[model samples]
Target chain A: MIGRLNHVGIATPSIEGAIAVYRDLLGATVIREPFDLPAQGVRVCFIDTPNSQIELIEPLGEASPVHAFLKKFPQGGQHHVCFEVPDIHAAAADMAAKGATVLGQPRIGAHGTPVIFVHPKSMGGVLVELMETPKGDHH
Target chain B: MIGRLNHVGIATPSIEGAIAVYRDLLGATVIREPFDLPAQGVRVCFIDTPNSQIELIEPLGEASPVHAFLKKFPQGGQHHVCFEVPDIHAAAADMAAKGATVLGQPRIGAHGTPVIFVHPKSMGGVLVELMETPKGDHH
Candidate 1:
């Protein structure tokens, strides 16, 4: 079951610029600096919002999943909604049992958080991401 | 200043279908039922998450904002992020002073909640919505 709304992912052309806007204009504080996740071929930055955080995603390579997204929707925009779960594997298995297609096997995401993506086809054409915060990572 | 992320807005083809996916499959419960906002030309349903809610938006008319988005993207996807603010008018003025273009004057949104949107171009091309919860409407 979902524990919380972890973060909302926004795909942007430049993480630095996004960070600046959220920080300076919107009064959001930078929670984390840009970090590269080579496996996902993307660089990410987090901005602290009131109740949750805003994740800025910038594709690092041509093969990044976001690359295709950018091509189809040139306008950078909201990308995904990630829900916090107690156990990623169990949540994914439950979803699979309910006829949802799991996009990838559970794997370590940014900052060693266990994450899995649910296919858009099974969720009314909206991509959903589920993440389980590692033990002792609570802020 | 923003307090926390209130919700993430997702544009979907069918609000009913999205409700099933978020509730039955993803373990999100429906804290709010479908509500129509004629001014915005969309119907919305909210799925409760611990930190925030996932707002599913369905365009009601051809001229609806989500309608145009769907026409261009075809695939339903994340639409916008709403940040909770203590004062809607103050937040809008502050954002405008910081060079962000306000979509329109702050107006009552679904459930009579005051809300305003900032232009995507001014916010790193990601549409950002600001909302102020009425004192008596806190959930």
Candidate 2:
């Protein structure tokens, strides 16, 4: 079962520009500096809220999927929503059994935890990511 | 200041179909039954997660904005992300001073609270809603 809404990923043309919107405009005070996730092919920044986070992501490589997404939505937009599940493998099996198309096998996600994506077609057109809750994180 | 992420709005063609995806497919147990928010021109259903809610919305009438969105995507998709604000009035002024366009004046949202939307163009193409945190409903 899904435990919590982990984070909402917002693809951005420039992480610095997005940071300004959240910090200066939205009055967000807990933004973390942008960091590169080489394996994920994206630059990441976190805007922490009281109960969740807004992840600002920018394409980092020639073949990064975010680049393709940016081509479709040139200005960048909400990319996907992630939910923490009890177990990634079991969640994949459950999704398959319930008729949703699992995009691929569980792999390390931006959070450094096993994660799998469900195709947007089978999910009402909203791309969804299922992540294995971090070992020590019960929430 | 923005508080919690109140909900992520997903525009769906069918509320019943979206309900099944969250309940049967995603193993969500706390799904709320669909209800009409005629003033907002949509039928709404809430999928409760520990940290936030996933709001499934379907166009309710001919003039609903969701109809325009559905015409574009057809299969439905993420529409907007809503964050709770301590004061909607002040938030609007803050956004104006910082160069983001407030879509319109704050009005009654689906949750029966004052809410305003920021133009997607000004926020990295992410449509954002800022709602006044309901009295005594602090997250």
Highest-DockQ candidate: 2
List the candidate 1 regions with Cα displacement exceeding 4 Å: A136-139, B136-139
**CAPRI-style docking class of model 2 based on DockQ:** high
lDDT of 2 at B11: 98
Model 1: pairs clashing at backbone N, Cα or C within 3 Å: A50-B3, A50-B4, A51-B4, A51-B5
Alpha-carbon lDDT, every model: 0.81, 0.91
Q: What is the DockQ of the complex in model 1?
A: 0.71
lDDT for each residue of candidate 2 in B49-133, tens digit (9 for 90 to 100):
9889999999998799899999998989999999999899999998888889998899998788999999999888999999999
Return the interface RMSD of model 1. Answer: 1.9
Candidate 1 lDDT by residue in tens digits, A50-118: 567778899998999988878865657778778788888898889999999998799888758889998
Q: Candidate 1 - CAPRI tier?
A: medium
Share of the reference A-B contacts seen in candidate 2:
0.89
lDDT per residue for candidate 1 within B1-139, as digits (tens), equals 7776777888888888778777788777655878898888999988877667888899998989999988865667778888878899999999988888999999897647789999888877678888897686555
TM-scores, each model vs. reference: 0.91, 0.97
- Quality of candidate 2 docking, DockQ: 0.87
What DockQ results do all the predictions give, each relative to the true complex? 0.71, 0.87
